[model samples]
Target: MKVITKILLCFFFTTIFFSVHIKAIEEEQSIIIEVEGDPHKHRQYIEDYHPLIEVVQVYDTIFTGIALKGKASNLERMGSLHFVKKSYPVRTYQTNINRSVPFLTETDDIDTEQMKFTGKGVKVGVIDTGVDYSHPDLSANYKGGYDLVDLDDDPMETLPEQGEPTLHGTHVSGIIAASGNMKGIAPEADLYGYRALGPGGRGTSIQVIAAIEKAVKDGMDVINMSLGNTVNGPDWPTSIAVNHAVDRGVSIVIANGNSGPANWTVGSPATSPKAVSVGASTPPMKIPFLEDSFEDKRIELAPLAGSKPWDLEKEYPLIDGGLGEEELPNARGKVVIMERGIVPFSEKARKAAEAGANALIIYNNEEGILQGSLDDSQGPIDIPVAAVGKKDGQWLMDHVTEGEYWIDTTYQNIQDKIADFSSRGPVTTNWNIKPEIVAPGAAIVSTVPGGYRELQGTSMASPHVAGGLALVKQAHPDWKPEQLKGALLTTALPLKNGKGLYNPIDQGMGRMQPQAAIDTETIIYNPMLAFGKIDKLKDSQTVDVKIENVSKETKTYHFELPQNTHGLSWQLPKSFTLEPGDKKNVSIQLSVISNMMDKGLHQGWITLKAKDTSYQLPYLFINREADYPKAMGLEFALKTFSKEEYEYRIYLPEEAKSVTIDLYDPHSLVFQKTLVTLEDTEAGVIEGTLKKRNITENGEFIANVEVKTTEDKTYNYQTVLSIE
Candidate 1:
């Protein structure tokens, strides 16, 4: 009888110990709590919770919230508090810069030197990985700023000793207002750096929001954010902060993102309605293409950064290099073709170069063409590297297997073409057309930490517009933020793809034309018409467009009929005249016959004739429920305060009946196991935690997510997940 009692006591003690331990682990989660009243007043209340939640920071300017660390169960309980409005999981953001000035200025037609619009007396803030204000070109224009990471006034770029050093913000600032030997678009604009992202160019959404509020408090006329995350929702926290900043009279510019060449890839901050999101376009350059020996096939090559340029004129034998993660088959004096996965692009290039390969081509594992860069940390790769689409790579691989295949290079003098890396979008939920405009982003030479360096991305494209807005602001100090944004969009030059002009989602109004924007007298607000999703067979939508005559003379406007489509019809306003300084709002209606038209996204341009020039306003609408990705922005990582637990977050476009994430070996592509499975997941961000004991292994994995929507539709998405 004593032995039985001892056994029961031992069992009870073990159960109690584990319950307390689990509770301790669960209390380490961090989230941002938005409250109904002032966040400062509610801090004590949050800290006094049963589990003892810690208030990290209180925000009152741009966002009324408090960042706190506590148990998820307590977080839900706090949500029930009358003062608590909502809560958001802290999401991380990463740095996402330069350009030829003459290409955008149209110097031949309008001499900027003669015009003397140098953006003097305008304050422009760059919120990125901080800046090297000591650079010779940027020193004179460098104004004081703050560092959110360190909570100080010294907003310098991350140093080597501090962590991973960064030059991204310096490059972006130079593009806006470099005052030395290399002149930027607006050389005289006052430049300030907000160090939101710290070491390794990484920062959380809270830091970003804090930086925006700081910039606004400093009374910055314009702000540029070259950093973004993979969340596509328009209502994300950072995006909402952007809208609020714009409402406060600050002109905000954001990089559309680099996850592109595919539709619906534009991420947060860029998805903000009031922000001017910029995309990438190439300046005048020689683009390389590979042709087969028989001249039967040709494929475009997007050269990777930090590698030798593709200048091979002679035909070279092509050999498949698998994933380039392992040993290569005799590739001496030949071109190596590798698939993109497992290892970094720089690692693959290093292996190929060691194998005496003349060149390297890494193809995408997914549908679209790959736009990649070699890691600078791995050192320079001697051989030239380029990327191609999966289909083209597979074709080359098939030909290589059949027999020996040789390829020769040809060059196309391409300019104003959309860079494949520039993210595209008709933002989810709101279905708004993003990337309000494109700018020169490819091979832009600007200021780095030490000297000048050439970098490329939508990051470089954003500063060009920011600088242009500065010039506009200097030229018309009376104009509001909306007018400045509208001026750029209405005057942009439309860009063309292989089929025709690139869609609004791809290129927006088109590449930025600063000279035209400065000289234009008419500005059209809400130029890109997004009719959203049409579910009914006979659906009609009306959009309000505001037109302002900024020119000195009276101007008359009339809309030309759009191309005749079977199921689409339009109602345009009658010809109307607006005198100088006059503004009017006009309603344009679109009627859709869904049964007669094809289902999916439909977009085109509507012409509006104003005086001698004709303006093309982009229009977009979906016939029925469009087939956008069901899941995206999947992220998994170990908890910051608890190593024994792992957390994950994913964005779902619609309510899903079930969501499953399957893990696969990066190299072998074999199924490992189901990493996560959930039922009845709602739309928006779904976040959860898993015990470390549940995982079989910890390493890098290729996560293939299958989401079944409540409507019985299934969609798949692929991403890389790493755990330690």
Candidate 2:
């Protein structure tokens, strides 16, 4: 009896320990980890987690996907990794998300009527190689071109232009305002040129800056800078130049970059705050996965994982061979994968030729592999070479796709989301936040530095935003870069940033929604421009327009400052023009400060205005703001919301320091009206809270917040009231 009892006790204790171990894992949040980049990296990462979490393997380099154990469903809507969207008229985009629609090629990606650029003579500058004047789709709209590279006539490349025909500049120009059968968002708009990058997509920040300077000087509405740099330095000329451009009323769009895993990283030019940054997004559709055997080819042109060569495309052919057969078995017209460092990737290609291979796949020595091309410095070799990670290489070894495989060959590069490769943001370096938005990067079909081709990277994504910016510009030509920036940022829709539970450093602010930004109803700072009024703004300079969102909610709208003003000088605007509750920024600049002498006395008062509220600045007739304290504090009480979302009430106690509230008055503190809650458990209550709180503020002031459901509907109740 004693022995049996002891055995039972041991079993019970063992059960308890197992239960505790299981519980610990369940409670832990998802974490990102870096391990060896080998073919077994993913397996090794999750090897110990067996019975804890089940994984759906997609690639060899893939360690782990996002953890969905307890995340929101909306955030986990990955399309390509799940379902795929149908191809757009141009091409199909694969995504794990089901609800996301494909590109606008077939079904309108955006409301065509909203474009508003029909007759508007706007010019979107493409600061690439140059615009192509010959492509069937882009010919008619080719206004004229300039080559910043050679600084000569015909920015367009000739037949002998050192690069591929795709570098003609027509493809990129088309994406901006493709005038062919498939209408571009900015159709009917003029195409401007500024050749920055050269063949094979290489250019300097100085050249890019020079292009922007020229575009601004020529008064182009939008300048498209669809290239970037991975490394950062003390002096970022691109960012500095961008600030000046915004101040000058020109909007610049820059590409993020192609490199991967760069947390908080963004491509140059795009990282510039004064410019709009763009990332990549997959096509919201299901498409074929184009694949060919690498072992059949002699040259490496696929990603590094494609270690072997295969014959499939038929476009390329093998000249020699082995294996005791008439020709090498896998050495015909297919991309090959070769290992780098073993006598150089290019030299390996030459060796493969002697062995009867047509293509080469050169992967990296790192635990994982990568895909990139080698320059022409090596001995003569003419075949496509592809690089990949070590892990991907091993996977390719297993899934050799045979002689031919169903692949979306037309599809772009690896849709693998990364951090270190993404542009870094909140960069104190340039004093600006970058990568304002993200999109699909791989296999990107956009304008190439030289011309037309499917180049992948954040480089392709930036042009999309620039084109969108042009469309926005057409709608509001008077909008200063500040106004446009505000609408884009505040109105951007939040989505899964990366493979992590939260936004991976790679995914900046969030995915940009072109339509949503243009239609939101909340009010951020509302500043009105008065050319030469009370403030005595310089006759030719821009007037600083200070605007702030006292409301504790997101707002979006279109704004425009006159572009005709000459000699304009004002800190154009903060890289982040839009603000949240209480944040403030200089709205406009009055160039009259001949010396710092007129700085203090210049009196051009910018009237604050918004499209949706009673938030308006009347003629200076209501300027009693001088009588009140610099700021007013709201000390009222109310109910609080307790659900996932919280709503509270604030009542302005009936004090008469001042009756009205104004945002512009130096002495009058403004309260964000949207945050004012009207909910009270009882039928009557006086509840108010200061919308913009600052610990450094002193003295006291009073502000009146009027609540209105509609423009003409105003409910004025000074007495106690219930906030139901």
Candidate 3:
């Protein structure tokens, strides 16, 4: 989300072979990479390589003079040369790459028509802070809990904050098993609350693992984890624990991180194959309305009768138009009228006094009055500063038109309008596609310890999906975690956001449609077959294939592969055949160069490719494991997102002719490696576009954009992308 910039953000690559003609201009000084190999020695060139910038050319290979990152330093290797195979390179886009927030809504939307109709007698578990055991809506569903964080067997005691009260866990528990009047997805399911994080929303990896262990031991049908760390590397302990948990029948739903940047790759348990990840979506929004009351503490303690009069002493002057007149003309030591805006309530009061106004009355920009100020707290403003709902503001506007007084030195709001700062997606950084099957979030009226809390976040969205999974599991107690996850993925419905539509990269197989997944009657296969060589032809450039089923049921399907127009060129047949539980590998072979096309994102999914198709088996995302710094750029002008777009230009110094740019998603290469044309510019200002793409897979994708100066000097830059 767009956090205040002041907070140090804890928000937490490819080849192509092309010739270049650089008419050397002047001496250059940049890191140079010179590859020397026998020009005529084909296979030898691919196998042997070295970085020769300052060292003498010792190898028996041609010095394809220093590629300042791959551009031509000298204009010579211009005319195209023919050969059997050539290494492909990646295309480059602007360093401003896209990202996705991979998550699920745990639904059965696509084929809701066929799902088994029944509420299985199954209970689920929410391994979080704790649950609100006594609320009208969720009270009947609150089964029980344990405090994993405090190491307590009692789920009720989350922390000392409640003097034997806990909030986080209770809320989570309610989401999962809270049944009766107000319903949860698995209304029949019981709950085992494991408070991992304390009341402050803080917890370690150890605590989370502990919660998982407890849930598994307690026979929890489903476990939901809605929190995560920004740093995700190979050595995360949560991963190890969840992998073990998966071995058992217990299913898990983990939340993808909310912190953006460094493309907060899926952390710990969420990255685990069996852990179903739930990403956040924008909270439902409606125009703000003027109100007189709400459920928050601030609104509860409103003045019943006559309260203290507005104190004018501490009022400070606001900018040019303080509450006085030249302004208002008739108003003096009276209450001032202000629009709901940036300044704090205290500041507004101070400003009114500075202008000789006694009281402060502010209204929201929308139709009615707002319940409370998102920034309102106690103490700053000396004079009384009160707000009215949006409707009141409209009335004030209407009053002014009628030549009547418009000041109401009072604050009133009934229902609280949801705050808009709540983060939305297609997740901007991680690959979270949209529209995430939105469950309740934003001022959601849910159960709490003393009473209830109107909380919001992906955290809320997570438990809803978790609760739904409980129902799915209850229905198919025999299904494996993979089966459950596949159902969620395969039966998802794709949605559109500001950035086009959600893709696998961003939304991860689309938003979970529980009912659809539950009702699906057929299988849609997108298998990654390990096809062995079939034909041995003399220098054959192509090969054929077939399919066999190794499943318990007989099946027929169609196949499709990603477009391979680059170096590694190949395609598959449209149709294939299979039988019950048979071993069948499609036959396909090719004699292509290793570096075929540009390095970036590439996919190959096999599906029914037909109308009324069913059963889709998704292969994993294209991103591979790679290591990079876990921390960088925390202290910068990083806002949630900028409505204002920007442009950038990288000019190649005259000494450099062509430039090669590579985009990466973390250490993994993303889009096609692009080598842009930068010649004929006396003043350097190359153009680049930040185009958005729609994909539908789940994984953290990054692009490493590099530039090579004509003199062989190279520079590398990495950035995050989002195209759900």
Candidate 4:
């Protein structure tokens, strides 16, 4: 028996190596091809047509497609084949996890114990770095799962002997259904792991899609994926797969990417219109801020991960430490301020600690506040380090230059505020409001591989909603996936920022209220309205809202009168009654006068009253063609197998007439050469490869992307690209 097991393991490792070796040998690019007919037959057709192309995997459950690897030219030519519908490059994704279970449940006044809906019998699949099922907290409910990366049934978390150890999946799983000391929201739910991402918490699109297909085949009731790439297109392959999974009767929850405080940062899978995308919000906590002793102006401080907490109690003199790249002047028992550049954040923190500094402050080089983490590879720093925005940093620098400046620490008890790092969105093409809701993600403690740890991200927030949905599913087993989603969105608590209510694009209907969702008798589909761009005067758009009376009693619904605003008029449906268990669709029309309205994004909320309960539906519209980026998310990298070949991808929100990428010397600003150009490019992601022959030099170059839209308007975006 031992000999047989050893032989099987050796064969598995060899198969994995051979698969990777094939792609590394040639200038082959991995791609997922959506097919018009059967995927299995399509795979065979691809092989017969392009003899050298290799089909890695076939998916049919969630998405009908085939993953293959071939030379760029061969792959491009395959697109012209009659059977092929569309092709997407297999982009890489990383595990992006956890938190206070009671914070989430208690915030909504949910009594899981009394409700008797602890997600019993619900099969929740977690697609991430596999779970550590051996942990005592997860053993009972850890049913079974598959490892897509290793092509095996044992979906255990990556161990040290493997490439890079991971605990992300375990943390997420614990948040969903752990039954031991660290109780999850859905403690009795059955847990299944789908190891899409392997070592280093990284994997390609093919693995993720295969895992989704497996989960669908396994008849999962709910799926939670805390992994995503930085591509924001709604039609991206992973996002499309998510939509298909929802159509197959599985509730899916995804983490809105952690690229936040900026619009259009929400990535794929989260961009899926049908998936429950979640953003990170703070649990009740006393957040620390830095205040100037003289002016009493306080600046919010986000502590760097892996650093000591900012808990200073006394005022300390502030000193400018330049960039903190080299040895600093003698400074002891004072806060050292550094600019973010040249040196790594961890290195600066280490230098500051070595100089006996009490704390360190690093400010952004750009306009917004810096969200950063210290590199743990260099070991941990002893002193507390925090980040501030560029304006505050400049103010501190000026104060230090003129006279002695003393800074004191202050604390503010905050709750339900959106995390600065939480990605915001009005998804590019479709204009849907992503992160349809928010949840407590900041400073959440959950199960890790060995024990418990506190972590925070939208990755953590997503599982909260997933677990909440599991409870809702247990209460209403007959509800469709759409109904399950509506329960959460329509009943969420609308949150507010310092200025006022957060925009619909930022908070959607707002923070999740699990108890309200479970007890509500009505479900509002399309709870967030996105009336896309209105270009002409007196232009009108209508959205049909689906409302279901899921209760035992008949319900009458009516819309509240919106505040009068110039240039916009709304046509609302009359009060109507729905019989028990019946659903109705009502149209809401909005007419806009472009010249009378401000030419920018306008947003607000519409209230709907059903019986004694009322729900707030967030609404948004662009008065005219707003100045959103024409082209963004440009990525350039050398092919893993061949250094001489480079692959690039850029996102076009709308169809463009032409696109061009030009390179120039970073230092001298001298024109190098045009990298690539395409005509009549579609509105999704455009990917291609560049050969070494096209470039005369190798090093860092500034990439200037010029995009000409079909409307004859041009927009430019710039980023740095490197060649070796």
Best by TM-score: 4
TM-score for each predicted model, relative to the true structure: 0.82, 0.47, 0.50, 0.85
lDDT score of model 2? 0.42
Ranking by TM-score: 4, 1, 3, 2
Runs in model 2 lying further than 4 Å from the true structure: 1-120, 158-169, 181-183, 198-206, 231-234, 285-327, 330-369, 372-388, 395-421, 426-432, 446-452, 497-504, 523-724
Q: Model 1: runs farther than 4 Å from truth? A: 1-58, 65-87, 97-99, 110-115, 313-367, 375-383, 390-406, 634-650, 655-724
Query: What are the per-residue Cα lDDT tens digits for candidate 1 across 1-724?
Result: 0011222222110000000111334545545556788777798776665446666667788988766666665554655578875334456688772336867764675435525788899999999999899999999999899887766688999999988898899999999999897888889999999998888888877778988988998999999999898778887879999999999999999999988877888989899999999999999888889987474788999888666888898889999899987787689999999999998898899999999999999988866557677765656678999999999988988988988888888889989989888999989888899888999898788898877767789999999999999998998898899999999999999988878899899899999887788788899998999988899989999889999998999999999999899989999999999999999999999999999999989989999999799999999998887867778777676653454777777888778999999887666667788889999987888888899999877787667788987878777777767666
Clashing pairs for model 4 are: 99-444, 99-445
Instruction: Residues 1-724, candidate 3: write the lDDT tens digits.
Output: 1111212111211111111113344433121122334333532332243222122111111113221222223212211222221111111100000001111232334644322422346657776666656556556656676665434456653546544444655555555555544444555566666766654555544445656766777777677777664323322346556767767877777765443212334444454544666654433332222222232112211110112323333323222223222344433566565666666555555556565655556666554324342222333344445455556545555545565342222233322221222222222112223222333333343455654444445466567677667656766677777666555565655445546443333444445556656655433322222222212222224323223342456566665554455544445555655566453445444334434333323333334343345333222221221122322111111111111221223322223444443322333223543323444333222444332221233334333334544446554434343222
lDDT against true structure, model 1 = 0.83
Clashes of 2: 131
Q: Compare candidates 1 and 4 on TM-score and give the better one.
A: 4
Which prediction has more favorable lDDT, 1 or 3? 1
Where model 4 places Cα greater than 4 Å from the true spot, the runs are 1-58, 64-87, 96-99, 107-115, 157-161, 319-333, 341-357, 374-383, 401-404, 635-649, 687-700, 722-724
lDDT of 2 at 500: 28
Assess the local accuracy of residue 274 in candidate 1 as a C-alpha lDDT between 0 and 100. 96
Which lDDT value does model 3 have at 481?
Answer: 70
What's the lDDT for all of these models?
0.83, 0.42, 0.42, 0.82
Q: List the residue pairs that clash in candidate 1.
A: 97-460
Give the alpha carbon lDDT tens digit for every residue of 167-226 in model 4. 889989999998988789899999999998878888777678888998999999999999
